[model samples]
Target chain A: MKFSARNVFRGKVKSLKKGPVNSEVTIEMPGGLEMVATVTTQSAENMGLAEGAETTALIKATQVMLVSE
Target chain B: MKFSARNVFRGKVKSLKKGPVNSEVTIEMPGGLEMVATVTTQSAENMGLAEGAETTALIKATQVMLVSE
Candidate 1:
């Protein structure tokens, strides 16, 4: 399905830390840039996410925040 | 405040498009990479965001999704 998230990166699953409700999945990009995402444990299981699996990280534009620095 | 989101990039406001309820903001990074974000019009006004303004983009890990391709 097409997503409205502007930031989409292709990466490989580097690690998976599952909890009761949520799971933390780390995806390593081509340049070794790791993106950390927190997803529901059910979704993770549904996706059958595992180490070395190819995946794409999706972040919605509305979910993004701009901070003055 | 420190954020839990792993992906954080410093950029300058490239453009701003405002609607009745939401506003679309585009920030340009140092290397010309642009990140788009959708925020509430109230927030845009509260932050006093304008063109050429420097800012940081924040995204929560929980808000990120993983898609298998």
Candidate 2:
């Protein structure tokens, strides 16, 4: 599925770490850029997001307001 | 934002009914079609989805499997 969000990044699942509350999935973009997101375990399982899996990280442009260095 | 999902429907909020746990928001599409979705009240308020508001209902094509009448 192609999402229309302005900041669509095609990435590969670098790692999957399960936490007590939520799972932290990291995606590595083509240019060595990385994005970390928290999602429900069920969603992770449903999406079949695993290491080396190709996926798109979707975030509403508005939702991605700021970045802290 | 334009989404690239296979099924994209432009819809308007017809009604916003709040439940104790979740909110039931009904969206009316352009061709007199309607889709009912359940979302958290916080998400609704965050998205500013009020009656008469224009919004896009996003669901992964795979997520929308089938409908049984």
Candidate 3:
């Protein structure tokens, strides 16, 4: 599916940490890059996310911040 | 400054497109990976973003989504 998010990394679910309100998901992408995402617990369950699952991490351009250093 | 965002990429500004409310900033990072970010025009101006400027793109874990494909 095509979306507006500019950053999309295809990866495998490396870990899952479920919390009351939010769940932390870590995806292991190519080149050893890991992307972490936090989603609502409800959404996490709805998606049936589990470790070793293949998923794509999406990040909207607007959500990205430019930090000058 | 240290931030909570899990994804931090250092790159040079390759291009900038300004709109009424937002500006599209394209950063070219190592390995030829290009990341695009949309920021408020005000913030873009405040940051003085331009071509060839070095900046770090930050994306929080909460702002990311995982999609199964």
Best by DockQ: 3
Q: RMSD, each candidate, Å?
A: 2.6, 10.2, 1.9
Ranking of all predicted structures according to DockQ, beginning with the best and ending with the worst: 3, 1, 2
Query: What DockQ does every candidate get?
Result: 0.61, 0.07, 0.71
Q: Encode model 3's per-residue lDDT on B1-69: one tens digit a residue.
A: 788898888889999999999999999877676789999999999999999999999989989988885
Displacement of the residue A48 alpha carbon in candidate 2, Å: 1.2
TM-score of each: 0.78, 0.51, 0.85
Best by lDDT: 3
- Clash counts per candidate, in order, are 0, 4, 0
| lDDT score, candidate 2, position A27 | 95
lDDT of 2 by residue, A10-48 (tens): 889899998665678999998899999777666677677
Cα deviation at A28, candidate 1, in Å, is 2.7
- Give the better candidate number (1 or 2) by DockQ: 1
Cα error, residue B68 of model 1, in Å, equals: 0.3
Docking class of 2: incorrect
RMSD to native, candidate 1: 2.6
The C-alpha stretches of model 1 lying farther than 4 A from their native spots are A30-32, B29-33
Worst 10 residues of 3 chain A by lDDT: A27-36
